[model samples]
Target: MAQLALDDYPDRYHLSNELHARPFPELTAPCRAAHLAIKQPRDAADRDRGRDFAHLVALLDRHGAPRPAPGANHYSGPLGRGFLKWEMHTEFVTYTIFADGVSQRPFSGEVFSLFPADWLAEAPGLVVTSCLVRVEVAGPDLEDRLGREVLSWFVPESLAVSQVVDAEAVVAADFRIDENGHCRVAVFARPGIGARRLGRIVQRMLEIETYKSMALLTLPTSRGVAQAVARLDGELSGVVAAMAEGGGQENKTLDQLLRMSAEIAQLSTASAFRFGAAGAYEAIVTQRIEVLREERIGGRQLLGEFMTRRFDPAMRTCRSARERLEELSSRAERAANLLRTRVDVENQAQNTEVLRQMSARAAMQLRLQETVEGLSVVAIGYYAVSLGTYLLGPVVEPVGIDKAHLSGLLVLPTLLGVWLMVRRVRARLDHGATH
Candidate 1:
């Protein structure tokens, strides 16, 4: 087994290693962390990721830390007395720095100041969300003071407090941005909690904040989509009403309906990615909180309950907007198809009338042709008799007959011969035409 010789897929080892990547930091209590998620306002998903990587390197250079290999999407290393972790995501990048101890003024400017002002200003994109968090060692004597601190540091009305992970720690946050321009989160770990366990709790809190912010980004988009859907719905209904009324504007109504359908399709396409990303992020927020196994603290709201009252409605709105857009698209398509069928039937009736007129014209032309042929035979027979009188007069002079008598006698035979000649020509023409 030590040296088995077998072919392996090129990505096998790389994929296996990825599972161990982005490990939770081994953080003890009495730690301070600052996290930032940055994204380009426009086209973040298809951004030039190299710029994100370069920005990360600039910060790593400031700390004199070893750089990640080229094209790497994740890195963890030292920064001053803290550890700096960077991860690149599909639409954003995150930077989290964890230090050994809390600042004198915890959850304040001190933690966020870890990133130099100039460096932050030069970041590749705008900050989607940023936060400061403090993790402290729990003490039996400080329980009362800690409770008071939570009420004072966070907005009482929106605060979420819970004992999590079998009560190994307690977590609290108001989920609101403070004057310092960062959301604040606090954690207290009971005695004997391992570094890894403490790290996991802190990570979960930041994950919840990061993903929740991302998920809410879709709310405003959903509102805009809703408005568009409403306008399109009304216009489509008007077009449908026109179709029902039959104002001889089927072509016009059909054009309008098709345009509405195209607009709805465009709206759906534009909003698809944001809605999908929101749902995914929302699920992540829920899952991260679930793993903590939270129980309410001091009758304060748990994170799940808070989300149910606030966040869930926004997600539902987004879903409703998407569904309405789809429904409107279907309705427009159906209307357009119906109008087209009606127009086709009307056109088919018009074509039938035209064919009837053409058949009548052909019958009239055939009768006219027969009349002309009969007149032509009579004219030819009269000329043939005049010519025969001249020729037969010379022969009849010897039999006691003149030109006038010859003409009268030749008329019957001349007309009969002329009729035979006309019939023969008509037969040849008809046969040739059929072949």
Candidate 2:
């Protein structure tokens, strides 16, 4: 028997392996991590991505780390005292550097020094989010030391501390920028926990911070749009009020409405991508927090609670701004439609008046036509009677009848006959026209 032929899809393998593209690093406890997220300008969707690749190559070259494959979106390898993982996202790139051991001092601002100053200075984009995370072994008196030493690292009021991943690790962060312009996160993991578990914990914490900051980037845009929309609302209200007052200026009102609608459309178009991105990033932050399944540590507020109190209101504001924009757009469209309807109605009224005038003129013309027809009938009858009188004058005299008397008798009948004939002819023409 012949073997059956098979067809292969070109991207089958590549697509299937996409989920594993960025596997969580294997991290033992007692490690220091620094995460940096860099982004280009908002309007630079088509900016030169090669700059990111070039910068990554420079860093790799300095540390003699293995070069990433060409056209790769992510890479992970060793760099001197740490292993660096770099991932290029749609709007930004993140580099996570992790060293195997913590410094002698906790949260001393030394962990982030792993990045070469010269290399960072030459970065291609601006830093949007930077975090210093320190993972250490949990000591016997971890709870007691937290208030005295750990809690002091962050603002006491705003600090969020929790035990996550079934109490595999305790995480603490204040979500504040220090003097060095970096956020700090601390994780204390049980010594017996597997390295992969620790890695996952650290990854989740860093992601929460990065995504949170990214989500807030749209706040300013939302505020600006809100102010612009408010002005348009007032203008639109004035236009609608004018229309209600029955101003004979429908054309002007329509023009104003069209301009308002166009401006709203432009605003929506400009902010569509940013708004959508913000929503997506916010969702990711929530998902990351949920997966952590945090429990309170020593009656302290959990990270989720902190986000609810501090971060959720900002997201709500962004949402409200978007809703307001949509509402204004809808109102503008409705107003324009109303104005068009009013214009159409006014035109109809004018047309009705014109038709009434035309009807009056038609009635006058019919009356004049009737008078002209009567005169024509009379003239024709007179001519007919004269002709009859001349032809029958001799015959009438033989019968003892005067020609004048005969002509007078024939005039009445002639007039009646002519009138009837004219009426019949006109009637036939009218009937034909109707058909």
Candidate 3:
């Protein structure tokens, strides 16, 4: 059989590989996992990503493990007896360690000691969140009461306990930072629960903690943005009200409006990525809890209920702040447009008045010019008549006619001819100007 000749796209393999990357760790029960997420405080998404890769490589070297490919965003392999999973995200990077046995102290923060102190001091960024997950398989002692021992491990006030995956496991977490500065989550699974299902549950628990922490990072930003939005809103309202008066100084008012609009746009652009990223993380948090199909344990609250009471408001604040910024930006844009139109109309009115005044001045000047032309014709005609009478006095005497009467007859004819000639010249000049 002959295969058809075809050309592959430049990124076909890379794109296909992306779909299968970052697979969940396969783990059996009675295990311990330590998860760490690190992010830069400023411009994290634009920071030098090579430093992150270098840090991962350094860790692999310390453990005598193979390194991930250059430019790869994820890696999973053995780090001594424990396994390591590393992933890079848009603004942060995460590392998770899975070991075979649970700690005797049950999340006493020993897992974190796996990373050398000097190596952690060289981390590329600050710790956004770190968690200790302890997975235990149900035994004769815990078969009927998986939550009994965990309930005592966490603080009772903020604790959340749930049965997930059709009651195959019981998960409990107070979602509180312990003295060791790590969030603690516990999972107690049934004996018959497959390794894959337990792995999935453990993955969900880590994601919820990490993403929840990431989502709340926007709350402080939202508070600052809220204040700015309020001030801009007030200023915009005043500018719009001033525009309604429709008077002079439109250009100055418009300048003020434009400045306000520019500020609004700036605020929107500055906070856009953070707010959007937080919103996405919040959705992931919700989805993870939903897929767990969480059911309450005894009179205790479910994970979903705990999130609703404590976490939902912070996320909503992020959303509300973003919404307000967008609304304020739109309002400023509308006001600027209206002010510009008003300025145009005002300028047009002023121009129309100027044109009207110019037209009136032109009409008055034309009348004055016509009066001066009539006076010039009279003066020229009088002079011409006087000269004719003086020169022809003797010639007319022989015919019995007086010089005074001759001058009288010449007066009207001279004036009429001069006026007609002046009219003809003025008509020619006016025709030239019209063209």
A best-first ranking of the candidates according to their lDDT comes to 2, 3, 1
Q: Estimate TM-scores for all models.
A: 0.91, 0.84, 0.92
TM-score of decoy 3: 0.92
Task: Give a tens-digit lDDT track for model 1, residues 1-435.
Answer: 597688898999999999998899998888889999999999899999999999888888887889999999999988877889899999999999998888777676575666899999999999888988888988885558556866788898998888999999988888899887899999989999989988899989999999999999998999999999998888888888888889998878878887888888899889999999998999999999999999876677998998898888988998898888888888888988999999999999999999999999989998998899889888999999988987778888998988888888999998999989999999999999999
Residues 82-101, candidate 2: write the lDDT tens digits.
88999998888999999888
**Which tens-of-lDDT digit does each residue in 274-308 have in candidate 3?**
99999899999999999999877677889999999
Residue 98 Cα positional deviation in candidate 3, in Å, after optimal superposition: 0.8
The runs of at least 3 residues in candidate 3 whose Cα sits more than 4 Å from the true structure, single-residue gaps closed, are: 1-3, 143-148, 241-249, 386-403
State the TM-score for model 2. 0.84
> For model 1, what is the alpha-carbon lDDT of residue 55?
89
Which candidate ranks first by TM-score, i.e. highest? 3
